[model samples]
Target: MKQLMQALIDQGARLIGLVGLPPMGCLPAVITLTSPFSPRQCNESLSQIAIDFNQKLQSELKAMQTDQGPTIVYFDIYQPLIDILQNPSQFGFDETNIGCCGSGLIEATFACNVGSKICPDPSKYVFFDSIHPTEATYNYIFKKMQPVIDEIIQGQ
Candidate 1:
């Protein structure tokens, strides 16, 4: 991923945003990836994969934080999402771990939707299904995190 980003920069790409995964292996998709029999405890021996990579790039970006160049910007979507999930009630969400979709521990393909039975109130839910969020949930997340983005832009 780093190599690919660097290549894009070398090729004169202007903007870049690393909106990486949100602890995805913890999500329901993995259950089907292995099986329902798979235990969550198995993901214990985790590597510092995204953190290491992003921090390295972040340091580079810090150095390149000058008011020059064609907007060497980075949008870190991971940290804020994790923070939101940790405090879902702040965003009017009573639940975070359980998806609105009834397809427990299955892939996002079997997600909650119109045809697939979904929660009557998507606004109260964090995830619309195993992977995505409802529009209202996204709106709440956006409103909550707008300050972070505004600060970054203003400080820059």
Candidate 2:
């Protein structure tokens, strides 16, 4: 990621932005289909990893925020996913587990077709696919982060 950042710098990139990971618990498939054998992430290690990763992301962004470099940011994907999962009704939805298309409770995939079980409206779902956010989810994320984005881009 650092090397990529420097490469972006070399190539005259500006205004770096990121959309980060959401909480794992809220993913329907992750919750429903995840391997029980898969051990829970060690808190000590996960915390360290989060700290290290955040530091690195910040370092890379700060490095690029120099006079001749772009202002960079790591979007907070964690909270939005949490908020959506915790309060789907706030976003005009009644369910978070039900996807807008694909195999509903079984799987989420790109094979949405004529008979696929699509939700009534996509605007309310937290995720569009089994693993990705829908347009609605993306819009919500954008709107939620708009202030931070504006602040960062505005050099505030």
In candidate 2 the C-alpha lDDT for residue 151 amounts to: 88
Considering every candidate listed, which one attains the maximal TM-score?
Answer: 2
* Candidate 1 error regions (>4 Å): 1-13, 31-48, 60-68, 110-114, 144-156
State every prediction's TM-score relative to the real structure. Answer: 0.63, 0.72
Q: List the residue pairs that clash in candidate 2.
A: none
* Candidate 2 Cα errors over 4 Å, as ranges: 35-56, 63-65, 152-156
Clashing pairs in 1: none
TM-score of 2: 0.72
